[model samples]
Target: MSLVFATSNKNKFEEARKIAEGHDLELEHRDVPYVEIQADDVVDVVKPSAQQATELLDSPCFVEDAGLFIEVLNGFPGPYSAYVYKTLQNRGILRLMEGKENRRAEFVSAVGYCEPGYEPRIFKGKVRGTITKESRGSGGFGFDPIFMPDLGEGGTFAEMSTEMKDALSHRGESIEKLVKWYVRNNRADGDRNESDS
Candidate 1:
């Protein structure tokens, strides 16, 4: 069986698809138009969105929301990262950090899954990093070109290949959690169905 991943972003869907494939799960992308709520954390933003998506599709589905939090800026774009990226973009962020010494930042991703008549389940992941002085590569979307993750070899997220980025990405971590949980639960459900038959 395939699980639906409701998102408008092809890039995000592709990234999550790759992770799901590694665990033998099929992910179907449904570009559902669901409203995201403004909240303190990405988790809060995704939970309702997932519930909305499940209602819209009349099936179990998942949605992911991510944010970029700059330590120096006091998480200026934590839950508002999408609007911030649309309005300010990466250049505006660099300009704000022009004279700052502390380039520390963090990227957080929350994947919320929901089935009909059930509350959404949340899986979260975060990665700490520093903002680059200038935009780097063209591999990733959003603030990727400007964020240098602390886990990798000094390269920004956009500088690395998709495989490399997935290995170190916050989205990857959260999606992995969702996939593992889905796999276990799905198998048990299949067994129950077979027993009933």
Candidate 2:
């Protein structure tokens, strides 16, 4: 009936709730201090955290991780987006792009889910865009103000409303995939229960 999402980011918590609501499901948020392993791939980074989180909570839980990769920078912060954000923030990123001609980039998100007896399931999402010339708008977080997605009218993620951003976000897309998996499994589970009954 409910799923647990383990993350420290309240922004992620809110988006996961929206994703669940969109699919007629309930999601509970917990900032479980699960260990996140540093890795080259997003999936690898998130799965261990998911495993530890579910074990700690003894419940079906998921962990989401994301990154912003820029083409010009040769993916300088592919799996290290969080660290880059903490160190460089937005202005530093813009400075890195000061004279670059190639501005292509994308945001990638990976969601990992786990239960006690099964392997963690991984779902991923990506959104293509470019780094803006300067920060724009006043919403969203992290690199939102500097990264403009290709989905909308040349607006940064920070410019879009939560509803608008959710519609085209990497997190939203991954959550959509996750919700589909949940729905299919839930239906199969209900069918099994019915047969048993």
Candidate 3:
């Protein structure tokens, strides 16, 4: 009932562990960095990362890549969100949005899962919203302070509680799809054990 999550981000590890716990699965962390390949799409990057990590660990494992795509910018940082976040930060995004009414954007996440002898499977999730004029709240990380989800109550992701954000966030949606796929494919360790018994 254990699946290795290929990531070193503590925040990601915590989120993934919470999701796995909800599904009654033991999620183990493999603290290794996979070389991120430059790709046109996040799936392309995540699939290879998952495959590489699984090979290194010789076990079932998963990796995720996410990005912030601004409609106004024609997805300038779609596959380079990490770099953008590190370099520009929320203030930079707000600067980009200043005097621009078309603040439409979305956050996309791709989760790639790989088993020892199986082809990788990808699950995608997205949240649509607009960039706030200024950063709000002190919760969440990265662009959360400026990225406002359409489902939220007039505030940025950083303003929402973890429970509230998870209930309506892009990453949550991706994890839900991942859990569904695992259950459907009998890849969930608990389900596999139950079937074996």
The candidate that wins on TM-score is 1
What's the candidate order when arranged by decreasing lDDT?
1, 2, 3
lDDT top scorer? 1
Q: Itemize residue pairs with steric clashes in candidate 2.
A: none
Give all TM-scores, in the order shown. Answer: 0.94, 0.92, 0.90
Estimate, for each residue in 1-197, the C-alpha lDDT of model 2 and write its tens digit: 67888999998889779878988889888989788899877877987888899899998888999999999899878889999999999889999999999999999999988877566878899999999899999998889999888888779999999888888989988888888778768724322211100
| Candidate 2 worst ten-residue window by lDDT | 188-197
In candidate 2, residue 83 scores what lDDT? 92
- List pairs with backbone clashes in candidate 3: none
lDDT of 3 by residue, 12-127 (tens): 77777787778877778888767889887988898789888888888888888889999888986788998888998888877877788799999988888888766677878899
TM-score of 2: 0.92
> Where in model 3 is the C-alpha error above 4 Å?
188-197
In candidate 3, residue 29 scores what lDDT?
Answer: 81
lDDT of 2: 0.85
What range of 10 consecutive residues in model 1 has the weakest lDDT sum?
188-197
